[model samples]
Every structure is written in C-alpha cells, then in structure tokens.
Target: MERFVNWSGSLAFDAERLRQPTSEQEVIDIVHEALDRGGSVRPVGSGHSSTPLAETGDTLISFGRMAGLVGADKSNGRATLLPGTGLAEAGSALAEHGLAMENLGDVDYQSLAGAMGTGTHGTGRELGNLSSTLVGGTLVTGTGAVVRFGEQADSAQGQTLLRAAQLALGALGVLTSLTLRVQPAFDLHRQNWMTHIDWVLGHFEELSQTCRHVDFYWYPRSDRAQVRVLTLPGDEPAISPPGYLKKDERGPSYEVIPNFRDLKFDEMEYMLPLEHGLEAFRRVRERVKDRHRDKVGWRVLVRTVAPDDAMLSNIRQPTMTIALLQNASLDHEPYFRDMEALFLDWGGRPHWGKKHYRTAPDLRRMYPDWDAFLTLREKCDPEGVFLNDYLTEIFGLQGAP
Candidate 1:
C-alpha cells in the first residue's frame, strides 16, 4: 500500500484502501463499489491543500491514470481535460491551440480538478478564481450515478449543478473531466522588489488599481514587503531600473504567471472584503510582530482577487487575500488560530484549500449560497459516501449510515 502524506507533511493518514481510476466509467464503478462496501471515498491530487479536506481512512481514490487534455474547441475558447491533469500540463495544452486559462495560482503543481474543487485562485483585482473558469464538468455521484453538466445549460438544474461542482470539495462526488473557459494566449511584464511594510499598506489601493496582478510578502519583523506586480503585455511605455528590481519576461501567460516555490510551509489564508483589507492587515501584522513573534516564523503573503459566483467560493466579493505562512518546523496552531480570529472579526472568509476552522453555521453565514450547495450535495449523494470526518464536521452533516 502507498503511504498517504501531503506535500508539506502537515497531513498524513493511513487509508483502508486506495483506488486509481483511469476513465469516467472507471470512476463511476469505483464509487459504486465504495458505496456498496459502505466506505467513505476521497480523491487526492498533488496533495497541495493545507487542510484535511482530503484525508480519509477508507477508499482513497487517485486519478493518476485519468490525466491529460481530452478535447479542445479553440474557436469556442473551451478546453476539456481529464481530472488529474496538472496546471502546468493544462497550460501547455491550452497554449498549443493559441489559448490559456484566464489566470492561475502562483504554484502550478496542483491538479486541475483539485484546484477548481478547492477554489484555488491567482491575484488580480479584475480576475476571478480558477473555478470561475469551470464552465462544465462530469461528476460521478455518491450513489454511483454518472452525470455531466456544461455551458449549454438547457435547465436551471444544469446551471446549478455546474455552479455546485465549481468548488464542491469532493462532497458532491468525483469530477472525471472539466471544461474551462479559455482566453487567447498572452504575455506578462512581472516586476518585483522588496519595500517597506508601511509603504505597501499605504499604497495598497493605488497598487491594486494599476497592476493586472499584484501580490506581496510582508516580513513584519524586517518591516519590509516584497512587492511583485504583473502587467499585461502591451508596448504601452516603461522605464527600466537596475539589476533585479524589474524582470521583463514576455511570453505566454502560462510561462510568466507561476513563481516556482521550493520552500515547504504550512499556510492559513483568509479572503477579506476589499474594504476591510488594510485595517485587517494592520491588525494581523501587529499580532505577528507583537503577540505571536515566537510562533510566526514566515512572512505574510497578500494578494487581491475579483468576485466569483461559485456556490462555496471564498471570493464572493472583490476580495483581498492575506496568507500567514509559517515554517513547518514551528507549531502553527497557536499563531494560525490567533490570526483566524482576527481575520474573522473583520468578516474574512477562509480559503477552502488553506487552514481554516470555521464549521457549518459560521460558514453558512459567510456564503449566501451555502444552503443551495448543501441541498445539491444531499440531492447528489444522500448516502454520504463522498464525505469524511473532516467534511462531516465542516458541513455539519448528519451521521453517515
């Protein structure tokens, strides 16, 4: 049996069984078998999520063989891909047809299904999350029913089904394939430099308005912020600075978007309302610097994202993301708990894939469409075969049969 461990070693579990499904029908059959055996099923991707959303002791499923671009319609700007395809592969495949995903997270290592299912997003004030690009997908429900939802929505049910699948977190079922809304290939002008923390907070609004993508790291101890900005490709006009202050990388969006990360750390991020962003950052920075100095080992990451309508998406409004990442060597619970408390007081919504402690009732108040998502989940998987302890607690689900 293969050992189950997350990328950061933050989450690990021993499962009763592991299954890899290669085709849509295979995924369906596996679901049927798991239900028959009265076992919970969970699908894992690159193990990139910091949360225990994927940890299950029974019937762990892998789509290792169910990967790659299955189809593409360049004229319609849509691409269908198997669930296990990685972000890097999806980018390359889309580029082949003069297309690209609208935006992508900094880490390009997550699987397409995993990223969308968890609401992974990139930093852009005018851009939506990865799930927003999910116009269609095929899912195998808990009862072993194979259903497909797509763009040419003939009914309100199909539209809601697609919306629910956007960020369902494996609660609805297993996603076999996804169809994304693609854009024409483009390039980016990425500029990065380390500046003072106060400088970043002071110019936050201005920075958000001018850049296509803006993200930064706040080292409260050093009182500095590593500010990075990506500008869309156009010869509009620019002045050059010395050495590494500005790197002009002009290529496909896929090539320029991701910042390769080698360090391993556990992170807790919250999606705060844009209006509440600055004050919340000030409070969290103070907590990191003054109250939790001994526990907070890594810097704070900040980014902005536009509104997305996915039923469970964290970015329900134009949101600002603040991630507190700590070295895996330290105890993150104390620091993370404190930070979450502060962010929540400011009306922040926890990123689904990151560390968060909010359960059903609190989460229900956060998302307006929460009830609708739960209704769909029940409708699709009454047996609760798709749920694990983590999901059950978070969703406040009834006891599994």
Candidate 2:
C-alpha cells in the first residue's frame, strides 16, 4: 500500500500505508488505530495539489479505491459523493441527472475533496470557487469522532463548521464524503485568440464584465496567447459545440501551456488587489516593457474566481491575478528579487503554494489574519499530525511529534 508522491510534478514524498477505506467505519477504525500507536494520518485525494498539503511522515490515506456516485437529490439539486471521485467523472454523472457544478477548475482530474481542500477554481464574475458549492459533508474529527454538518442546519456550531469546512485543509480530520450544490446542466460556447497587452488592458473591465466565463493566457516568449471566452445561450436548451470547434485541442489539459520553460524562467505570481483588473495589467505591462526592453519574455494571463478563505485564494477580494514567468536559471536570486520588488509595489500577494522566496514575517504582512489562521490550525490539529517539512519551513510551526 506504499507509493511515491506525484503532486504537480514538482516534489515527491515516499508514502507508507496508502489505505483506501471504502466505508466510514473503516476510516474511523484507521484513525483510532493511528491514535493508539501515536502515529499520524494524511488523507490524499488524486495527488493534484501544487503544495504538499497531503504529505505526512506517518500513514497515507488515499481515497482512490473508495469512489463513485454515492447519492443525489434531484429536487434539491444536491449530490453526495465519496472523496476519491474525480471532478469530471462526478460532473458527467451529475449531468445525466440534469445537474452540474456551478464552477470547475481548468483541470478535471482532481478529486472533489482535494479541490475543495485547496480551493481550486475557474473564472466567472458572478460564480465562486468550487468549495463555495459545498453545502455539507461528514468530517471525522482529530479524535476519531464522526460528525455531519451542512448549510441549512439551524445550530450555531453547524453554521460555523460549514463555513470552516469549506477550506478545512484536511487538518481537522479525514473527510469521508461531500454534499455539493448543483446547477442545471448548460452548454458553453468558447472563443480563443491573441491580443496586445495595451488592448487587453484597455478593455479588461469590459471583457470581464461581458463574458459568462472568460480566461486568457499570454505566452512568455511570444506576443500571442491561446485565449478562450465561453458563453451560454439564453432561453434555450444547451447546444453542443459544432463538430469542428469541438475538435479544437485542449492544450496541456492539466497545466498551463509550458511554452518557455526552457528559458529557465524564475516564476512569480501576484494576487493583484484591485477591482478594475485591467488597470493592474496595464501597469505591469508598462513597467515590464519599459524596464526589460526585450531582455525578457513577458506573458500575461487573466482568469476569474469566486472568493473563499482557503488561505491561498487569489480572488479573496474582487481581484485579478497577473503572473510573470521570467527567465531565472541564469541568476535566479536576482530575478526573484526584481520580481518581488515589483509585486510588492503592485500590492500583490504570492500564491501560498508556489515558488516565492518569502519568509514568515513577509507572509504575515501579506495576509491580514495570519496569526488567527495559525490559532485555528492549533485548535483543530494540536497534535500536528498533518505537519510536514514544507509546513515547518513556511509557517515555522514546531512542537509536533
């Protein structure tokens, strides 16, 4: 039951006891056993994270073997599922019942629990992240106690648990199942293209406002992007894309197009803290073009998200995130230094799971409730079962066994 970790092709952690519990009782027993032996447990779902959220030095609980449509409520537009169920598989199953998730990330391979745990999302002005669609689920507490919570509950603890569970981080305990809100299945029409940074900035507001769902990618080495804008027809049953358009390639399905990785680009992502996203893009474009002057490759991509409290959500506010993929292999430190300066100037926050070289003090300034989040983690997982080297280096949380 052991396997090598394969999260986002970056780092790997060797695992012991990759348990796939098919029943809640099995999960409870495993938790109790771990507690008795003074061992820890980490629940892994699809290994899709860019961060080491699922890494544990003790036992690994993989949900892959415990998957399928558990139940659905057609009238209420709700579905309950096992944690290992893949997003696309669940989406298609829900579609057969005339239902779909309100939003989905670009990659469909992630499990429902893992996506919610990390706040995976897609672009839409009115829509929120996938975690927001979670109405309720069963959380096995750190003490191996099983509790069920949902949105419509009348109790105060239930309400608090529902909100907190939206981004539980798997620190609270193992999640056996989830109940998600669903919308009527709909068809999407997509358009893709390339544009100059100036034009994109000029119309960024209008573009974001107009589309039902829109996202763009600017190539690092080139002036073009495989941009896509999706729209749904009004007052009509959803129509499938024409055969020709449907045949269009879904470039690098699980990842952004890796056009200039060879450039040894040191990458940096800034969570732009402005409502009028176009202004941020315009500013970044001007600064980079004026300063670099053909010495670097610039690629600007735009995507949308609904807000959440995953601690790493880019759209925590009504915001836009503009990423700069620059050549860094030659002088990685200097390149990062320059990027960090500009990012801070833009009031940008780094993606918590990426390659930013910021320390805890720096991250504290970026997140308003950094200490409060730590307090929450302490309360939920005082034993530090979920702790890993990455967590220690980033947050400096010691005292875990």
Candidate 3:
C-alpha cells in the first residue's frame, strides 16, 4: 500500500513497505533488513521537504514513533531530541526549561531532525542555520552499524563526519537522535510594514545589520514589498501593524519567530552571496514583469543566514536565500525553472530540501565540499542502503530501479 505523501502533495512514492521505528535498535534492524533484501531505505520526517529527498523505491521509514523531547543538558544549554520531534513541540519543551532553539523559519511543522538535516534556517545576519547548532548525532549507518558522532568519536574522520551528517539529506544514514545548542528563552519585539521594492533594496545592508531577524516579502505580480523585522524587546513600546501585514506580535522567541503557514505552496529557494542578492532580485523582477507575472501571487521571501561549515550547507557564506513560492494547486515547474536560471546566473546554491534543477555534476561546481561529502557517503553507506533515487542522483550513486 502507498502509505505516504508530502505536505504539498507534489511528491509521493509507493514504498514496498513502510516502517515507523520506536527505538534505535528497530532503526538498526530495519537497515539490516533492507540490506538483507537488497533494497534501499529512505527516512521520512514530517514530509515537509517539497523535493523528493525522502521518496524511496523500496522501504520508507518515518520517525513519528520516536517523537518528542528525549533529554536536555541544563548546564550546557543543549537538548537531545528524537528526530521525529516537531519543531513547535520542541520549542514548548525548551521554553519549560527556559531555553529555545537559537533560530527558526516561519513555518514550524518540520521535525527537528528534518530541519537540521536539510540546512533549514531562520533569518538572522549573525545567526547560522539549524545544522550549525548540531553538537552531536547518533545514527544507524547503511552497514547496519550504529555509530555516534560529535562527542562520541575522537578522530579527524569523526569530526568531518559530523560536519557532513549535520546537513546530510539522509545519504549517509538514518539519524536516530540529535543534540542541538540552545539558548535561554527570550522575548522579541516584532514589527511589520508594507513598503516599495526599491526602498527595501536601498536600505538592505543597513536594516539587515540592525535587526536580529529581518526578511522582505515581495509579490512580483503586484510589485509591493512587506518588510518584517524581529528584535529583542527594548525601551520602545509596541506599535500597530501596518495595513498590509497580518499583525505586529511579541512573545517567546520561538513562538514569535514562526508564523502560521495555512497556505500550502511549493517552494524553490536559492542562497546567493549577499553582494549578488539585490542584483538577482532586480533581474528576477524584470523577468517576472516581462514573462511570468500572472503565475505569481504568493510572495517571494528573502531572508539571511550567516556562514557555517556543514559540508552540504548553502549557508557557507553570509548569504540571502530567495524563496520563490507557487500555490500548490497550480503548475510550478516553468516558473521555478525560470527563477533557477536566474539564480544560477548569479552563482547561487539551491536549498537542498527545496525545488531545484541541480544534479550531481552541476552541484559539484557550486559546493567546495561536494566531493568530500561524496567520499564520506561512500565510506558510510557503501552498499547504498540509505540511498533513494534523489539521493542517488545527487550523490552520483547508481539509483535503485
């Protein structure tokens, strides 16, 4: 039976079997079973990734059985969570301990593991992506061997393995649990205003530096920009939200950071160097006006993330991610492809879990650590038990037919 589909319903697969393992031992056993059967396995979380990263031709594994807070390190401000733990749930748990994940994207539906695995990030010029906070991880490898990374391993290979695994996209193994660096719970003062596209560009650098979290949402068809900024509460008082925005809100950092995502859409996000971001936006604006204005109503979200060294992370440079959105009910390929071309011309890197047109060869040139990641993948999952068609294609493995 076909047991699953993604949130956007754009990607789906009929796995020969579906397994939700409640324990790490079960995960290890499933890997062994897939190996024994000469079939590959793919791990699925909340199915938040629009790309087919988790789609598999054989066995599909979901970590829902292992959901929720597993443990916490009060002294060091860390939390070890089962991969299936929902972001919002983890946020609430962290709050109880006077802590929270350092940053978060607007939508909180993704599992913690999925977020960390795919380089998911919040908008903060000084803050890094989710993978950047990974202090340790435990996973069952393709060889059916359980390995602990981060603090557990004491060699250069182990450290390199941690860097690769932080944003691995499941090519290496099935992550059972992860330890993340957290911070004390704090309040934020958020403000929203509707402004012109030109104004946002004119003050891009200044605003980005001043605000802890800021993003610009522009509807290309309409040519209007909604400027949103979040900062620590200060001597200033709350103000009314601008007419174009939902509302100005303030609360716990995690609670205030994510907006309710009721509108479903397929997305393609590309990380461009800060210097090229505005230029790319201008080009996309011209192209949208000249070619595909009618197809877009969903806003283009542009946000920032500081650099990090997770091998597959697109946040390797202080960058801005331009996320193009399309209503899930409509065809998106042509529009996304056009934007992909624009991004590529700007030397941008695609977000691993989002829609994109890059394969192994194209990606290798974009990522300096691409070959290194492939080497690690080979050593960890030599038999390809952890690979799916998408992983196979990206990592240059022989995809299972």
Candidate 4:
C-alpha cells in the first residue's frame, strides 16, 4: 500500500491502489474499472486542500501526468487546460499566449481543477472565486461516462449540471479538462505594510472597495496586522500612512498576484456575509486574545470574495472570509472549533476544501440549492464510485458502500 499525504501533512491515507492516468481515455477506463469492482475512486491534485476531499481507501488517481495547456483562444481570451495543470503552470502557459487569469489565490501550487473545484479565490471586491471563471469542461461522471458542461452544454439541464459541477468537491466526477475565462496579459502594482488591527477594521470597507485586491493578516500577540493591496499599475494609489511601507513593486498579474508560501499550516476558513464580517472578526479577535492567545503562534487572515452561482459556493453574496491558520505541528482543533462557533453564529459557510465540522444538516440551511446539487450528485454518481467515508458522512449519503 502506498501512503498519500496532503500538502500540509494534515491528512494521509494508505490507498489500495494509486494510479496516474496520462490521458482522458485512461481516466475513463479507470473509472469503469472502479465501477466494475464496486470500489471507489478519488482524484488527488496538488493536495492543497486541508480537508479529506481526496481521501479514498480504494483507489487514488493523481493527475500529474495529465497536465498542460490544451488550447488557447487569444481572440476570445479563453484557455483550455488539463485537470492536473498547476496554477503556476497555467499562469505561465497563458502568459505565453498573452493571456492571464482574471484573478488568482495567494498560493499557486494547486492544480487548476482542484482550485476551481474548491472555489479557491483571490481578494477583490468584485472578483469571484476561481470557480466563477470556469466556463466549460469535461468530467468523467460516476457512471463512467464523459459529460460536457458549461459553455458546451446546450440545454437548461446541462447548465444546471455545470452549476453543480463548479464546486462539487470531487464528489460529482473526475474532471479531465477545464476551460477558463482569461484576459489579455496585464500588470499590477502591489503594496504591503504593517498597521494596527484597529485601523484595518476601521477602514477595511474603504480599502476593499477601492483596491483591486486587499487582504490582511492579524497577529494576536501584537494586536497588529499586515495589510496587502494590489491594483493596476495606474490605478489610484493605496492609502498608507507614512513609514508603513514594507514592500512596493510592480509585475505581471501572474507574478504579482500569488505569494510563495513556504510554511506548512492547517487552515480553517469560513465565508461570512459582508454585513456581519467585521463584527464577527471583532468577536473572534477578542476571544482569541482572551482564550487561545497563549497557544496560538500564527496569524488570522482576512479577505473578501464576490458571489457566484455555484450551488455550493461559500460566497452566496458579497462575502468576507476569515481564515484561522495554525502551525501544522500544533494542535488546531480547539482554536478552530472555538472560532467556527463565532462564524456559524454569523451565518458563515465553511470553505469546502478547508477544515470544518459542518455536516449535511448544517450545510442544507446555508445553501439554497443544496438539494438540487445533491440530486445532481446522485444522478451523476449513483454508485458512489467517487465518494469516500468523509464525503459520505458530510453529504449524509445513506447506505453508501
């Protein structure tokens, strides 16, 4: 048996079989085999997800062999990529064609399919998560059939499938290819500075509204925060007080948007309504300062995401995401659970790819189209070929093998 470990080493499992399929036909054959054997299959990407979304005891499929830019349409600003293409790889590939993703998350190590499937996002008041850029794709459904959705879908049912597939957490099917909305290559000016957490809380709205990208990291021990804002080269300058500048630079959007993350950490993030975001953050800050300050040596991160219609997307409206990150070697459950209560009280939805305790009952209330997604999932993977114990439990799938 081969043991599979995630990026943070937070989740690991010994799989009975681990295979990397180099082509879509191979992926289809693997699925068909799994179905024939009454076994399950799970897709593993860069393993960036903190949750056990890709865990499976039966078979694990790695898409590393199936990565690259398949097509580029400079005229339409669209690019088709393989499921295993890394975000960084995609950025470079698109840049070669004078195109770039509209936005990107801080870390670019995740595979394009995994990022879109998990609704990974970058910070911007108007930009939606990466999933929102998913215009079309092909996935091998649980029934061992290849289905085209998104722009390729010609019917209302196909569109509905696209919505369900947008952020299905790998439970819906094995995504083999993804088409994303791209833009002509551009550059951005990035600025970073240290400030009091209070200042950030006070002017967060203004910063978020004016900057193309704005996020902050709150350090509990010092009651201070580090703010980062990115804007187009000629856009209005970020408001920063004297002597607060930490970094000022300009680069291509691909280079400027993502930051290298060397430290390994376990993260739990929740998306809360923008209206209650500040208040929730205030309460979380107070509680962390009072209760977990002694054990916590990490910072709390805050960012915003625009809403999209992905059925299970965390941001249903303008959303503020609060992420608690603890050193991977340290115990994070107590602190994470404590903050999760605060988030849930404020109608927060857990990031599907991150750590959370929410189950089907809690999730049903958070998503208006929960049942519809569930129905589609069942329709696609009736045999539960793509489901593992973790997914089965969270989805409340009854009698799943």
In order, candidate lDDTs are 0.85, 0.65, 0.85, 0.90
Q: What TM-score should be assigned to candidate 3?
A: 0.95
| Candidates 1 and 4, the one with greater lDDT | 4
For each candidate in turn, the TM-score is: 0.96, 0.81, 0.95, 0.98
Better of 1 and 2 by lDDT: 1
Write down the worst ten-residue block by lDDT for model 2: 251-260
Candidate 2 C-alpha lDDT tens digits along 1-401: 46555443544677767777888898888888887888788887776554576777678887887687788888998988888888878877887777777777766877888888866667777778788888888887767777776754557776557766776667667778898998777666455545544444455466677776666766544544545666664422132322122222232112221121323334456666657556666665666556553555545556766566544344578656666655442333444466667767767776543456777677777766566667666666666666666675567665555
Q: After superposition, which runs of candidate 2 have C-alpha atoms over 4 Å from their true positions?
A: 1-3, 152-154, 234-269, 286-300, 309-314, 324-341, 358-376, 393-396
User: Quick one: ranking by TM-score, best first?
Assistant: 4, 1, 3, 2
Task: Identify the candidate with maximal lDDT.
Answer: 4
What would you estimate as the lDDT of candidate 2? 0.65
Question: Per-residue lDDT for 1-401 in model 4, tens only?
Answer: 87999999999899999999999899999999998889999988899999998888789999999999999999987999999999999999999999999999989999988898888999897999999989888989999899999887787787888888889899899899898999999999998888888888888888899889999999999898898989998885547643388888899898889998999999999999988888999999999999999999799999998999999988889999999999999999999998899898898999988999998788888889989998999989999999998888888886876
| Inter-residue clash pairs, candidate 4 | none
Instruction: State the lDDT of candidate 1 residue by residue for 1-401, as single tens digits.
Output: 45799988899999888898878888888888887777788999999999998888888898878999988888898999999999999999888888899999988999988999899999989999999999987888998888878674567788889989999999999988889999888888777866677666776687788778888888767777787778876732242222246445666788888988888889899999988888888888877778987656788889999998889988888899999988887888888887898998888999899888888889989888998898999999998888888888888885755
Q: Which ten residues in a row are the worst by lDDT in model 1?
A: 235-244
Off by over 4 Å in 3: 235-246, 399-401
Error of 1 at 235 (Å): 6.2
Model number with the top TM-score = 4
Native-to-model Cα distance after best TM-score fit, residue 68 in candidate 4, in Å: 0.9
